[model samples]
Target: MASKESVCDSYLSLKPEKATIIEIIRSLFSSDLENERFIESSEEGKLERKWIILVSVIVQWVFLYIRVPLAKIGDVLQKWLNLISINGGLLMLFLNWLRGKVVEPDSLSSRSVLGNLDTRIELDKSIKPENTRYKAVLSIMAAKLSYENKDLVQSVVNHHWKMKFIGFYNFWNGYQGRDSTQAFLFKDTQSDPNLIVVAFRGTAPFNADAWRIDFDISWCQFNKVGKTHGGFMKALGMQPENRWPLELENDDQHSQFAYYTIRKMLKDLLQEDENAKFILTGHSLGGALAVLFAGVLAMHDCEYAWLLERLEGVYTFGQPRVGDEKFGEFMKEKFRNHDVRYMRYVYNNDLVPRVPFDDKALLFEHFGPTLYYNSCYGGKVLKEEPNKNYFSLRWFIPNRLNAVWELIRSFILPLVKGSEYREGWFMRLWRVAGLVFPGIPDHIPQDYVNLTRLGTLLLPKETPKVQHSE
Candidate 1:
């Protein structure tokens, strides 16, 4: 109890319960509709209403001793109905979220919308920065959809697409050659096999667990790193009694799952020629994995070392913060003089970049400067200011909603797809729910593709020069 009190002393003088209550009043009146889209506004409203009821009754009892709306207890009953309606709506939304909807593969999926870029760009030539980033977005989208109907994937171009498919993987529990991380190399059909896209896939539409795993905040030490690597002063920012947000445990980065998937790729892909060039790219979860893979490969010896040496650049869309400052600083420093360009592309109101950060601890910082795709000012990809992460009462709610959503998505998938497909229904609920609980809509691969297309057109015409140390 003494220890608890001691720890409590360091917190901002505001009472914790008072803080939540303040949130209630603020939320009840808030008109921020954009934020309302990703959160369960109905649930928050109920908290506000409950507090209002408690306060009103207390005032009545103190002033009159007994106020009789007792005869019109119907009003009290009506409030219950409102509660049911709000909760029921959330429940339905939750159910729809759970009933895991499978993404039907599109050959013409947004990635191929790169128009003639894929068929045109060659290995001998330097790729314009925008086209390189576009390919990264394409890689991530493809990684996520790799498990879609083979016909659907091959359906994009020809019967021969997957036949020439190189290094596509199927890794998961009981994966019958179809599961998450359905990543594949684009070399076989590319302008140059030597210049390949190591597209790690993003979260799949069918697997709630994939997104859940990606979003999980439990940080473990990165790969083989031993100790958390920040100075005492960084920790000094928090009151000593304040238990550091576990997410801020400096050495512990988001590992395990992404590393597991990436480890599967290291051995096979190492067989490429010495001069082979790999452009690493992906969206969302795939983006995080690309960094992990690239970082770990950079630390390797002999054969695998070339993976980093020949790495052309990394382009990711809406990726979350993956590592503590050490990992960020390590990658930042390691790539500082190297040939690789690690860049994260973000657009609109992407929330992923702000997350995995608990209480704004300086634990996780980004690698390179963000290549912000600004559509508001003009459609262009430009370097933005240094990033600072925050913790919001608003952001916390969606993660919980997503967890419940994942549970629903995993077990209730049967409801999503019967012999008569429910694509129409699934889309309707997803669209409606997105309006109510707006979580990461911009994180979607298509949005990334569309936003990137606009930004790419704005990229400077001059090709970025490469410095080859070899």
Candidate 2:
């Protein structure tokens, strides 16, 4: 019955020692230490079964003796008991399997896997080898440039053209230590002043394209607003030493920031030419910001409403919900003709996409087809699968239940609920039972892989190469 925060703290405190012991044990075992077979078999599954069986047997015996005689009552009672036993056993088995799957260490090392693959095959077919090599070289150059300027080159681009780069200024808010914002502008021989490309960074640092664009923009500064703070920080139990600028003041601020930033970038790019097109591209957080920024510009009645009309696309990778249901619907409507894609890449439940947000519907709806990838899951990487167009009731129901339970525990229950020893007793008993069960394999279906690929398409043409461990 420890609070979630307390539980997290306890886990963190023990992690170092636990990890060290585990490493020692693993080295001695020779077997793949990352595999969770031992823990699944020893901790969660079988342990639960032992307790359930014991309790069930005692209850059944008492019922057997006390039951009054009725036609076929004995037979009916026996059948019911058998069914209960079967279900209890099944539940234990399932829990054990799940634990084993989730707890297992990643067996593959990136170095070993990448070394073995034909670099040609590992490279995306759409990305020519020359292009990949060029990008890699550009990546090295950008890294050097960022190092020289004391700013990070978030990303580089080698898609169809070389010499394209994007960069960002590194600024730290008084509250949060360091905040980075992307500056995306493209320069070609036939530069269409109207054509503006805004590149968003994903989970990692920027590459060549982002660097090129960052370098092109003269007045660009790191984005200090619209960053997730209140709810997200609360969920993570994080508190800043000072007031964060991105802290939600009002809805208008959100809209204004989004509107002003996009307009300024567009005006700077199209100052020379009024008839050029404007395109927005972001991966992950960048994508969500691009969508919001574009929507704000549309609301402002800017002269380039046609550019908004001619909005080429909004490509996002592993993006979460950025706004409320109304905002999401507006985005979908505005970007209907222009490509708006969200790639949902999951490495065995990485837990980023599922971050609790106010407008769950944004993720559930508005976004186009979701590409789900299970490459991070054990076993062979399978083809991707597409999520249903709308929010799934089945998935939502469980999520809601969990959310409510968490809310009650954190907010409501602490006020009214009494501490009960029975709950603790049962939990410990269940944990013990889990220790005895056999481990089960976690299966990654091919459908998930296809979905991930579909999501990847939304990003600039770089495909994250998957390298396996030895």
Candidate models: Cα lDDT each: 0.42, 0.31
Tens-place lDDT per residue, model 2, 70-153, is 214533543433333333544654675667732221212111111111111121224332342223222112211222121112
Q: What range of 10 consecutive residues in model 1 has the weakest lDDT sum? A: 6-15
| Clash pairs detected, candidate 1 | 37-437, 37-438, 38-437, 38-438, 98-408, 98-409, 107-156, 143-201, 144-201, 228-251
- lDDT of candidate 2 at residue 161, scale 0 to 100: 39
lDDT of 1 by residue, 233-307 (tens): 111121233232222244333121333344434435546454456667766766776676665554442235445
TM-score for candidate 2: 0.37
* Candidate 2 residue-wise lDDT at 200: 39
Which regions of candidate 1 deviate over 4 angstroms? Answer: 1-144, 154-163, 172-181, 222-272, 301-303, 358-362, 374-434, 456-470
Top candidate on TM-score is 1
